[model samples]
Target: MRSTTEQTVQPCPQCGTEIRTDRRFTTWCSACDWNVDPVEPDERPGRVERMRRGIAHRYGERLLAEMTGGESRRPRRDVAGVLACTVALCVHGVTVALLLAGVLLVTLGWGGALPVLGAFLLGLAWLLRPRFGRLPDDAPVLHRADAPRLFALIDEVAACAPTSGVHAVAVTAEVNASVSTYGIGQRRLLTLGLGLWEITAPQERVALLGHELGHFAHGDTRHGVIIANALHSLNSWRYLVAPIRNPSGLEVILNALYLLPFLAVQGVMMLLDQLTLRAAQRAEYLADASSATAASTEAAVALQDRLLVYGSAETFLLRESNARQVRDRAKRDEPEQGLWDRLAAYVESIPESEYERRRRVGALRGHSVDSTHPPTHLRRACLLAGPAEPAAVRVDAEAVAAITAELADARRVVARRVLRG
Candidate 1:
């Protein structure tokens, strides 16, 4: 017989509300509605969660979501199957063409057809095999000591994934997280950026992890590796053949002929890549649903909001960095150009007149990528207004202005340093 004590009522830790107690673990506080205990202690959540919550509490939810959810997961592919089909098709096509050419050459007492066939085989082989580097065995792990609560939340979310288990986790300074499959079996790696941790909530962090796990569940990691290898092989063949000069007009024609196989292979690979990307986008939606299911609708909404804002800022920073790199390269290439001259040159290169250029640049300053993720304003509006009647979230023009100004200042600093050096 079951003990009645397991069903006894217990006082809510926060608001003094009475709640039934069936499990040994502490649950939600009924009175104040605060969480009484961490969601899952045995599972380690790591730094991604802590950074997310800290960003949310400081900058509000909208900023956090913008930052986290910008990039969707990698697309899915069937590497082995695709490679086999490609090889078989190429061999059959080349063999039939070579045989017909061989008959013509034999009747005319010519010997070049055999060489052409040899070159084609070599090119095809080169396009199928690719070199891959091993991921380091001792990559550093980011400690989650600073955000214990957030880590606990991640563990709870991870626990919900039944078939595939979560593996290693790492943090980078960029605002990104990805799950990669590198080995022969179920082995995988989950990488989260330090920038991701810097700007989201606990719930949002779980959403990010859940999204990554979705990639694993859908076999995207292995597919990505296969696609990458295929692309690499194609690229390698191009590199090898680029410097070799064709001696005969026939060689030039043969070069064009060789391109057909290359194009056919690449076209298929690209289509597969895009298909994978679309699948990844759908996975994001599913992960978002999973997050809502595991936590709450409100929590899922808040997570999305936080990701948008933060992800935008991070992308802006990266663009700024790239611009600086380009500027530095320009300065190195032309040391004689004056600072004012370089600035003037840059302004002149804009597609508009000086006045219009300034205005356009100003307009672009704080605005996030409108095309990348669903607009932050739209996402927020959807969350606040509900899915059926989704509206745009109200954005403060002043806040955008402020962020733009800050980025402009950073740019100016970079410009000064480059000019001085």
Candidate 2:
């Protein structure tokens, strides 16, 4: 027979009011609610960010409802997708037309002022060129030969996610992980952040990989070359046309001349964002479901819970960085060591009550990792509401040790950079 447990009866530490405590959740007073969310969210977003957040919060709620109601998970070829593609193609066509016109003017209108106009057109075309993503030259790249065990783990997770495997792995000091395509060939690269990697359990690591690779499997339209390059071009155009502050004389006249183009570009950007935002949000939900499939529902939910504490993790990093600076001034004899281990310990030391407090705060504020993703609470809810499946890929102890050994050099390099900064 299965066993059942009940909530533990307790009194509020601050209010002395009796309360029932669920072991799986936070224990806090219902009356006074002491020490809930000690850290408050920043209230200093710019006008644009605020508007985006408002839109994200409203749409995220609607998307969550549809997903939980068992809507189709596959990305469909809809009118929005077609319209977005059409707009992107038009943007690229404009660039191509500019290049051709510039060449024609230069060749046909020799010994005339037309050549000057051609030069100006050519400069504009150069500035607005499409930019493909590239692997950072400075980041340490890990190939499969160098880290077979880690690559094997990634390959296993890719199979479970049913996505094409990554071509290379890069490590960074940030508290995040992502998969991006780079170069003309669009070779996939997985950027793993040591700050997040060190804190996650084995299964949570699988969920992380699954979530990132899931982006590939789901065809996240935001990351596509055509749309991404068009967005980049629009942003560059916006920068070129932006009005300068404290302008005098002809600068003011130039700003006036640029105003109409600025407005036109801004309108197009808004339209494109609106068309793509829904699909992008839906893709995130599907990726979370994929993560649950690969790593089990419990581990996926736990990974989301860990995400809530990243603010505290960042705080710890800043603190350690500050402390490292002080030690350097003292001229310590021994070489610095164990920075990654300490970071892991610091994150692991956070209390369950604190996590619960942050979770509640996130829900109240509609907090998200970025404007692109849905609220963390909604993601957790979707995962929990789905089937409770076992992990599809498992890492034994031998594999874990081997993977850790492979990451040792990367860990050292990242530690040094973090400490020095």
Candidate 3:
């Protein structure tokens, strides 16, 4: 009795199992992948203007999207923070206004009402303010002065993506690469993990560079700071006024008065955060597309696939490699060519089925509702959506090799550097 379309099912693309059309999962393949998609090419920043509710400029984002000719249906997170910042400013202005009004009332010989209210608001604001600080500058950083060759390579990557020049690059023990903007117009900090670089093949490394450069290209780094600060500032405000213990009569009444209004603002911010997170994930997809355009798709795929395997295995490899430098210098007779090959060899010994299982679990999770970054599988899917481009740039072999040699010493000094702290 079912219609033809409803009854029909397509064979799984990867494993040829029947994908049920009648079910909610029409395209998903259980025996193969949970994620199935028709990824469209996109460069449009996002529809963030829709999020500006009070005196919202609804059409501005539409215009931007139309102008860009590509879009992913998620509100831009950083731009949404503009509303948060606006709310913060308004709250601050009101507090200042109350104090000034109170002063005027006292001068005019009015009762203490205005001054008392002003003092209360100001004190609440101060208490509610959140605190955060940047990572220590003393953390071992590699400057252009020390690693010109590496800087040259980074410059090459930036040029291909047409992004701003990196101000400083640092090597870290973490297995990741990140570019962060310190302030609105501040010099961007680029951190490349020795673990990721040590494991990446030359071509695959280009993909990683391209993806990170794409983040710069799209201003994701700059905007990310704004969104983070906005969220933190809001939390600070809430913290300043929230009752620490169970509220007694006066405390309960005061909390109800103070927190009720802010609760609505917090709820709005949370919703905005979710929307922006989706946008951030989409930004990641767009960045992956940029990576595919910069390097070969194979390179991007290889990098992602390798990253999955390297996740658990990498921690072990980095620790062993770092520990070996001091503990077994006598045993390490071989000239250090970097730990990629040996680490990879060890990972390859892992069953393919096991790797697939791990990849599946991670991919299925995608990005959490609040996560600002997308999952690796989502990135892989996005890269696959784009047609492969010929490698647009090559990492300078001489420069990279020289940098790697320097990084070995950098790694050796990392523990000691931290200890110096």
**Best-performing candidate as measured by lDDT:** 2
**Model 3 over residues 1-421: C-alpha lDDT tens digits?**
1123334467877788876643322245557564443333244322322232211223223323432455552335466546555654554454456556555555654565765665565565455333333433655677778777777777776777777657777676567887775544556778777667766677777788888877877655225544555565556655665554787888878877877756765664555554454445456665665566667788888788877755566556656656776765455554444455555555554444344555576654433211455556655665665456778776667756787776666665553432222
Worst 10 residues of 2 by lDDT: 1-10
The whole-model lDDT of each prediction reads 0.44, 0.82, 0.58
TM-scores, each model vs. reference: 0.42, 0.89, 0.64
Backbone Cα, N, C clashes tallied per candidate: 24, 0, 4
Error of model 3, residue 180, in angstroms: 1.2
Ranking by TM-score: 2, 3, 1
Off by over 4 Å in 2: 1-48, 329-335, 367-369
Cand. 2 TM to true fold: 0.89
Best by TM-score: 2
- Could you give candidate 1's per-residue lDDT for residues 157-256 as a string of tens digits? 5555322544444444455677665455535666665445335444455556655665555443223555446545545544544333744877777667
Candidate 1 wrongly placed segments (more than 4 Å): 1-133, 136-139, 142-155, 218-258, 270-278, 310-312, 315-421
Q: Quote the positional error of residue 335 for candidate 3 in Å.
A: 14
